[model samples]
Target: MRADAGAILRIDELTVSFRTDSGEVPAVRGVSFELAAGEALALVGESGSGKSTVALAALGLLGGTARVSGSIAIGDIAVVGAGERELQRVRGKLASMVFQEPATALDPLMRVGDQIAEVIRNHDDVSAAEAQARAVELLGHVGLPEPASRVRSFPFQLSGGQRQRVVIAMAIANRPKLLIADEPTTALDVTVQAEILDLLRRLAAENDMGVLLVTHNMGVVADFADRVAVMTDGRLVEEGPVDEVLLRPQHEYTRALLSAVPRLSVAERPAAAGAAGAAGPAAPAAPARERYVEASGVSVSFGRGVRAVHALRDVSLDVAAGETVGLVGESGSGKSTIARAVLGLIEPDSGSVRVFGEELRRARGRRLRQLRAGIGVVLQDPVASLDARLSVAECIAEPLLVHARGLGRAERRRRVAEALEAVRLPAAFMDRAPRELSGGQRQRVSLARALVLSPRLLVADEPTSALDVSVQRTVLDVITELQRELGFACIFVSHDLAVVQEFAQRVVVMRAGAVVETGPTAVTLSHPETEYTRRLLAAVPVPDPVVQRGRRLAAAGGAA
Candidate 1:
């Protein structure tokens, strides 16, 4: 391994395995690659591929159940057989890794400044004050809005995209030779994801570091990677330049993965209404039908007397039996508050909430349970929503078991199996724990659980926010298909206008807990009546080719 002029990191015949219940599971099978100074390489594969395992190996972060073989050289240092102490010394200086989940990776209790300062203090001989200054500088480098103010904030206070930027700042604090980003953009919206990828590229160029990007998105690979290595069942099946690999894949699995990517055609891209042809005026008012869920003069207030804070004010909306309505707004816009009120989790201070022509506030005990059971809710974070220790079957079956106790063991298993298949998971996976499944797979399982009871209404709160682009598409497709088949009313909530544009038929824009505007999705997106809506749409990052190419190079296995 050369340090000054050429290769920064070199892996020769690396093999990694884990101790599973069934026996030993070899995750990285004879993987080898060279990462040069200021280069990028992408490791791409499906959920079970060895991409993540290889990253852990590179960082010497593999746990007690894992074993490694062969040589991994980083800047003239052999990390393959290095002890814990030695690895720690090299970790921040030579190599750093940005994790998949920003929420879990960051410490919730610690202030953002302290975390970044800790990384600086550990790897470099810097005074506490100097380290703190470095932390602020790092945050600025990552494009945070206000580093000074944000430094005092906790992890929970920031958005998902903001937290990811914090993590990136920490990873690059010591200016490591190699930066391994494992699905760095998986949890972010497409627009935010693009920004993050661009930031990573600029950082890599500025620091003259190699980057190893691991992801499941073909569009990401095609757009960003300098070179791509395709993995299947822990084996490196194919390796080549990005264009050669994605546009003309030699491997069957690679081709399958490429083909699976959902692309929007020019026709599919919605045209500007007035620019093309003005949309026809709304039809003449007709006799109003009975609303399935309705809210009138809805207002919620907290505290007593002068201290009270109004969360929602004069909110009004309706969803027919088969209508899919979208609630779009920034954070703290009372979207979730309205949802809670409708679900009977909270009582509004004023106004009425009706479901099936019955008041939700008056509903109690069995009535509330029956109503809730019929209206399923899918939360943003699947891991938080589900019990990690439970098997898929148990998680899905718990609702059925509690509500419908008459069903015997066989019937329970049958229903559970049917639900699992409906979400496109194999029956064999039903026995596996949630930890074993990928983020997308776990989300599908959550959807399956929600759909098991044949609920008449579903409330999804940023359901696809924490998924890869490919996975997001799949989840959205499944939801749309099921919506058409079941004709169930739904309340789709998200900050991403692109996702909402794809899913929702009708759109409701909210701000500071008040409805800003309401109309068809096209009308709201294309001809936004309010300035807030225009700003929201304007903030969305278009898929730029230069940004994509930069991301691809940084993500690939640093093969420059």
Candidate 2:
């Protein structure tokens, strides 16, 4: 493709390949595109579709094993065949890249301010104090609150949204002409996602920079990008204006993807709303049998004396068999603590926990192990949870090996295959290592591992949050199907109300380490009583136009 008049970045016939044991894996297949100055183009595709590879290749960030063949021009310089030194000269000064997971991209051990300042020092001979001041200003520009104080904190000390903002601060520290953001909003809550998108838009507009946004979220691309490119199986299948792509998609893959996204506009809700009138499902009746897990008057305090902070205060709840319960809260709301307590991984200072009507808080050794064996957990980030060295089959077989040792080798293999199939994974993946799979595939493997033992209860903490929309839908479907087939209960924990709405029959609203409200999903959502639950429901993504219209109509009605 030729440059569109005056283009900041242009690539013609770019192809990228990696040498694998099976053969050469063609990642990007002769893809050609152009990004004019101040233009925002979205690279939309599912996992393993080569969207990220294209972005990585443009900045000359591909691995040594990758073979590239094409012409890439950034500004007036050619980067396709540039030497390491030449590329380094162009990297931060000409174009910068911001990865999806800011926590992983930023140095956890270093203060965030130092990391951003280092970028400036790498390009310019600047004093540490000057670079530090510039870093603080950059952080402020990215919409982070208290940027000065936050700059001194480590990556772990900031929220996911704030961490992403810091990463943006680092990316734009050198004021590059082009910024490549790869799935910047993945795994964030809807409220935080909107804020981050807004920040990116403002930054790109203010700098007059070309932005290459790589994501699978149609909502984001439709609302933000000027143009869109659809990729499939390492090939660009469609390219056009964002509206044309979203409203009138030509490619079958794009159509399938658009159809998969769940919309809240016409979603089914419960017969009654919660106290706050937030849309939710009707509450289901609690099971009559003894509670499988119960916590009473739970309180957890951190630190000591003046520094002592109460993370959980008088939190109480119960989970019954054959039921799915949702724990809803924002980050650091102590929902994870609740999960940990149920798993016997944490002990509350002043509370009683009972499993199957037996005291579990005091249980130790054999009894604790037995209780834990009946429960399973799927964490938010699968890459961190999975063992990179183990093959997919080996990972799935671990739970079975622990309990059913008497089973023959063939039987164990057969069970592993069945578990994999349950999660809709291809059988060929059994031989592949965790590193070989994409983010979504690794999550499926985690689900397979958890389900192999046929546990009665599953603790899924944002299980599909890190995946693309297509992958999220598929993963949720697998979990629902497995739950129905095996008659296993689930404790769905997430900040995404939309996802939890689909999974749980009941919902529990948690804030500041306390259960503010609990009721049937339909009833509570349709009519949320607590202000926190209402805020959470309102924070869900509605188009800006729709929000404005709703406000206007409400104002008119109020006046009438």
Instruction: For candidate 2, give the lDDT.
Output: 0.82
Tens-digit lDDT track of model 2 for 307-404: 98788899898888878899988777888888888877778888987766667777778787777778888999898898888888988888877777
Give the range of the ten consecutive residues with the poorest summed lDDT in model 1.
265-274
Q: Pick the candidate with the highest lDDT.
A: 2
lDDT over C-alpha atoms for residue 142 of model 1: 98
Candidate 1 lDDT at 265 equals 27
| Candidate 1 overall lDDT versus native | 0.80
Q: Please provide, for model 1 over 1-560, each residue's C-alpha lDDT reduced to its tens digit, 9 standing for 90 to 100.
A: 23333478787788999998899988888988888878889998866778888888887889899989987878877776778888898888788899998999999999999999999999889898999888888889899988988988999989888999999999999889999999987767555776787798789899898999998766556556788888878888999877778767898887777665544221123323323234545634434554678999899988889988788999998988777889988767888889888888889999999987889988889888888788878899888888987888898888898677889988988998988888888888888888888889889999989988888888898998767566787888888888888878899988767677778878898988999989887666776677677545544433333434443444353336
Window of ten residues with lowest summed lDDT in model 2: 266-275
Which structure among the candidates has the greatest TM-score? Answer: 2
Candidate 1: deviation at residue 35, Å? Answer: 3.5
